[model samples]
Target: MFENGIVGSLIMIAVGIVVGFFAGFLYRKKIGESKIGSAELEAGRIIERATADSEAKKKELLLEAKEESIRTKNEYEKEFKERRNELQRSEKRLIQKEESLDKKMDSLERKEEQLQRKVDAVEKQKEELAQKIAEQKDILEQLSGLTREQAKDHLLESVKDEIKVETALLIKDMEAKAKLEADKKAIDILSGAIQRCAVDHVTESTVSVVSLPNDEMKGRIIGREGRNIRTLESLTGIDLIIDDTPEAVILSGFDAMRREVARIALEKLIVDGRIHPARIEEMVEKARKEVEVMIREDGEAATFETGVHGLHPELIRLLGKMKFRTSYGQNVLKHSIEVAHLSGLIAGELGADITLAKRAGLLHDIGKSVDHDIEGTHVSIGTALCKKYRESDIIINAVEAHHGDVEPTNIISVIVQVADAISAARPGARRETLESYIKRLHKLEDIADKYKGVEKSFAIQAGRELRVVIIPEEVDDASLTILAREISKNIEEELEYPGQIKVNLIRETRAIEYAK
Candidate 1:
C-alpha cells in the first residue's frame, strides 16, 4: 500500500509540476505583452511631445525673427531720419555760409572800387594843388618884386601874427566857457552832496560844569586846607575851580579825559560826603577806571555806529581818546563820525570805494589824539601811527593829504579831504576867537586885493568866501578864471585856515551908450 501510494503521489507531483510550469510560462508571456504595450504607449507619447515641442520652437523662432526684423527696420528708419535731418542742417549751413561769403565778397569789391576812386581823386587833387601853389608863387613874386623865399617868409610872419591873435582869443573864449561849465557843475555836485548829507554841527568845549546840590558841596569838594582839591587835581590832571557863583563847580583841563575824570571824582566825593585826601584819591582812581571803561565803550560805539571794523586794539583806544579831544571847540569824535558819513555818501555818489573812503575819513584825524604829547604835526603823527598799524597805503595817503600836506594818491584820498572840509567848514561847525576871526577875514580880503585886476575885495561868509570885483578892461572873462585860481592858490599856500576858501572873481563890462 505504501509503494502504490508513492507511485500515485509521484505521478500527481509530476502532473502538478507540468501544470505549474505552464502557468509560469503563461504569466511570463502576459507580463511581456503588458510591458511591450506600456513601452509602445510611452514611445508614442514621447514622439507627440517632441513634435509639439518642435512646432512651438518653430513658432517662437518665427516670432523672434519678426521682432528682430521690426527692430532692425525701426533702427534703420530712425538712422535714416537722423541722417536726413543732419544733411538738411548741413545743407542750410552751407547755404547760409555761401550767402555770407557772397555778401562779404560784394562788400570787399565795393570797398576796393571806393578805394580806387579815392586814390584817383587824391592824385587829381595833388596835381591841382601843385598847379595852384606854382601859380600863387609866381603871382606873389610878380607883385612883391622879391624872391619866393622872402615873400613866403613875409606872408608866414603876417599869418603867424594873425593866427596867434586869433588863437589867443579863441582859447580865451573856450577857456571861459569851460570854466563856467566846470564851476557850475562842481557847484551843483558839491551843493547836492552837502544838501543830501544834512548833518548837524556840534561844538563842544573843554570845560565841564558839574552842578552841586548846594553851595556847601563846593566847600566839601575843596576839602580842608584844599588838600582834597590838590589830591584830586594831581590824580586826575585837572583844575577844580570852585567859584562863588551858585552851586556849581567847574572842571577845567586841556585834556578832555582828565577833565572828565576830575568831574566824575568831584561829583562822587560830593555825594559820598567824604572830603578827605584819601577819599579824594580813591574817588579819582575809581573815576579814572570808569573813564577808561567809558573811553573803550565810546570807541566801540563809534566804530559800531560807523559800521567800521577790523581796527587794532590800540587804534580803537586812540579813537576813543578822540571822544574827549576837541578841535576849535568842535568834538573830534563827532567831527570824525560826520566826516565818515559824508565821505561814504560822496563816495557813493562819485562811484568810489565807500569802505576805504569811510575808513580814511574816520582815521584822518587820528594823529590829533597824540599830537599834544608828540612833537609833530597831526598829519605826520597820523602817518606814523597808520604806518605803525600797517594800514593800507591809500589810508596813509588819505591821512597825510587831508590837510593838503601831501599830494593825494587816489580818489579816496580826495574824497576824504572833501568830506573833512565839509565837516569842519560847515556853518557853526567850529568856533574861533573874535580877534583871530577878524584877522582871518582881513587876511583873505588882503590876499584877494593884492591881485592886479581886483577892483574891490570883500570877505564874506565868515572868511569862508572871498569875493573880488575885477576891472573888466584889465581882466577878461578868461583872465577872471585865472585870477580866481591864482588867489585860491595863494591862499592855500600862505594862509592857514580851518576849511577851504572860495575865491570868487567877478568881471562886468559896462557899455555906457546913452539913449541919445
Candidate 2:
C-alpha cells in the first residue's frame, strides 16, 4: 500500500512541474510577440519618415537641378548671342577687306601697267646701249694691237707690279716699327728680369766619385767575392766601379737619386766600419730614410722660398725629388727655382697673376722627378700629376703649355713658357753632345737652304741666329720680307729649338767687272 502511495506522489509532482514550465513558456512567447509587434510599428514609422525625407530631398534636388539648367541655358544663350554678334562683325570686316583689296588690286594693276611700259622702254635703251658698246669694242680692238684679254692682262700685270712694290714698302715700314718697339720693350723687360736674378749653374755629371781613406778600403767595399758590392748594387740600382783610381770609387747610374743613395750608404758603411751584407742593408735603409727626410725638407724649403703655399703634400714631395734631377746637365731644382723667380719678375712687369705664375713655374718640371719611372714627356706627366692632385685648370695649362707642346690658354701659361725658355736657353746652363750640336746647326742651315733664292745659310752665334744669303738677281728687295717670313715659318714648323732663333736675311747685289 505504501509503494502505491509513493508512486502516486511522484506522478503528482511530475504533473505539477510540467504545468509550471508550460505556463512560463506561454507567458514569454506572448511577451515576445507583443515586443515584435511594437518593433514592427516603430520600423514602419521610421521607414515612412525616411521616405518623406527622401521625397522632399528629391524635390529640392530636382528644383536645384532645374534652376542650374536654366542658369546654364541663359549662359549658353548669352554666349550664342556674343558669338553671333562676333560672326556678324567678322562678316562686316571681311566685306570691308574685300572692298579694300579690290581698290588695292585696281591700283596695283595700273602700277603694273606703268611698270611694264617703263620696262619696255628700258629694254629698248639697253639694246641700243649694247649695240653702241659692241661698236666701240670693235673699234678699240682694231685700234689696239693686242686682243681684249691681252690688254686686260697687261694692265692687271702693271697694276700688280706697282701694288707689290707698295705693299712691300708698307710691310717693311710696319715690321721695322713693330720690331723696334717690340725689341726695345722685350729687352727692357727681359734685361730687368735677368739682372735681378742670378743663380749658380753647373753641368752635373751622372757619375759620382766617392773618396776612400786608402786602397785597402776599396777591397773592403768590394767584399769577399764581391758580395757586399753586389748587395749594394742590387739594393740601390747603381753600378759600383772600383778601378785603378788611387783613393776613389765611382758610383755610376743614369738615375741620380739612386746614385746619391748608394753614395750615402756606402759612406755610412765606410764610416761605421761595417762591411757585411747585413750592415750594408741597414746602412742603405737608413740612407734611404735620410734622403726621404731631406727630400721633404727641401720641398718645404722650396715652397717657403717661393711663397707658393697650399701645394698638395705629394706635390711638395715631388718638388723635393727635383733636387736630384737634371736636364741637359743643369740642376733641375735650381732651374725650377730660377724659373720661378724669372716668372715672377716677368709677371710683375706684365701685370699678370704673379703668384700663379711663380707657382706654375716652380712646378712646371715636377715630372722630371719621376720621368724615368713614368712614360711620356715631362710636360704630359706634369700635367697629369697636377690634374690628379686637384690643381687649378690654369696651373695645369701652364704646365702643359710650358714646352710649346700645346697652345697656352692664359697669360700665366705664356709667362711660364717664357720663363722656361729663358732658363733653359741661358748660355752655359745646358750642354749637348758634340754630334747633336753639330747636327742641329746643320739642320738649321739645311732648313734655310730648302727655300728658293737662298744662296747660303750659316748658323752662327751657337745656332741662335741663322744668317741667310739670297741671290740678288733671283730675289729682289721687294720679296725679301715674304722670303724671310716663309723661312722663319719653316724653321718654326721643322725645328725643335731651345729658344728663339733670329732669321737674318741678306740680299746683296754686286757689280764686278774684270778688265784684262
Looking at model 1, the pairs that clash are: none
Least well predicted 10-residue stretch by lDDT in candidate 2? 197-206
lDDT of 1 by residue, 395-465 (tens): 99999998777889899999998888888975553546789889888988898888787899999987878
Write candidate 2's Cα lDDT for 218-271 as tens digits: 989989999999999999999999999999998988787788899999999888
Q: Name the runs in model 1 displaced over 4 angstroms.
A: 1-204, 426-516
lDDT of 2 at 108: 100
How far residue 3's Cα lies from its native spot in candidate 2, in Å, is 99
Worst 10 residues of 1 by lDDT: 197-206
Error of 1 at 231 (Å): 1.7
